[model samples]
Target: MEKLDHIDLAILKTLQENGRISNADLADRIGLSASSCSRRLDILEKSGVISGYHARVSHKALDYKMIVIVHISLSGQFAKTLAEFEAAVKRVPNVLVCYLMSGEYDYILRIACKDLEDYERIHRDWLSALPHVVKINSSFALREIIDRPNLAASLGS
Candidate 1:
């Protein structure tokens, strides 16, 4: 990765706030010429720094009302078991995020559902049936206080 100068950081910060901001406006805001801004942005995108632009969609709007935090302990820590578990997890639609961890549990998952009934179905069908899963602990999130998607990008090194 290339070193990000102040201008690059400024561009990143602006883009993080509003991905749809026009190039000219972004250039003006970051104190760069239009051509320079465009070139820099192109470089950033091509180099995989600026991955993709997307809109923030609400899960509640999509009728996913409950967020379940799940802690999973696998049957074993073997490479094959872990790989199979991760692959199976990706196939489940309700699983929003999964993370391999270094703690009491092997993996943690964030699952979204419409309600308790929906979560129960997912738990019975998906969670229980997951490959090599030995134990599953789940907790419901009462409310989402904060959900920042671009914290890393905004706080550049």
Candidate 2:
């Protein structure tokens, strides 16, 4: 990867705050010409520094009122076993995120559901049926303190 200079960092920081900002607006904010800003943005996208733009939706609006954090232990740590488990888990609808961990648990999952009854159904039908899953521990989140989609500090904002 190429080293990002001050201007590149500025562009990234600005985009992180508003992904949908127009090229003219962004250029004005960054003190660059519209064409220059557009060229820089193209380079950023081509280099994979700017991955994608997406809307941040409210889970509650979608009727997902409960957030469940699940810790899972697999029967084995072999690559085949882990790959099978990951592939299977991806097919589970309520699973929002899954991470392969380095601690006691092999994987950790963040799930969204309507309520306890909905979670119960997912736990019984989907989670328990995942391949090679030996243990599952779940905890409900009371409230979300913070969720940052951008890396402001890392970008030197």
lDDT per residue (tens digit) for residues 66-110 in model 2:
999999999999999999999999999999899999989999999
Error of 1 at 56 (Å): 1.1
Indicate the residue-level lDDT of 152 in model 2: 51
lDDT of 1 by residue, 74-140 (tens): 9899999999999999999999899999989999999999999999999999999999999999999
Instruction: Return the lDDT, model 2, position 136.
Output: 98
Residue-pair clashes, model 2: 0
Per-model TM against the reference: 0.93, 0.93
- Candidate 1 backbone collisions, by pair: none
lDDT of 2: 0.92
Poorest 10 consecutive residues by lDDT, candidate 1: 148-157
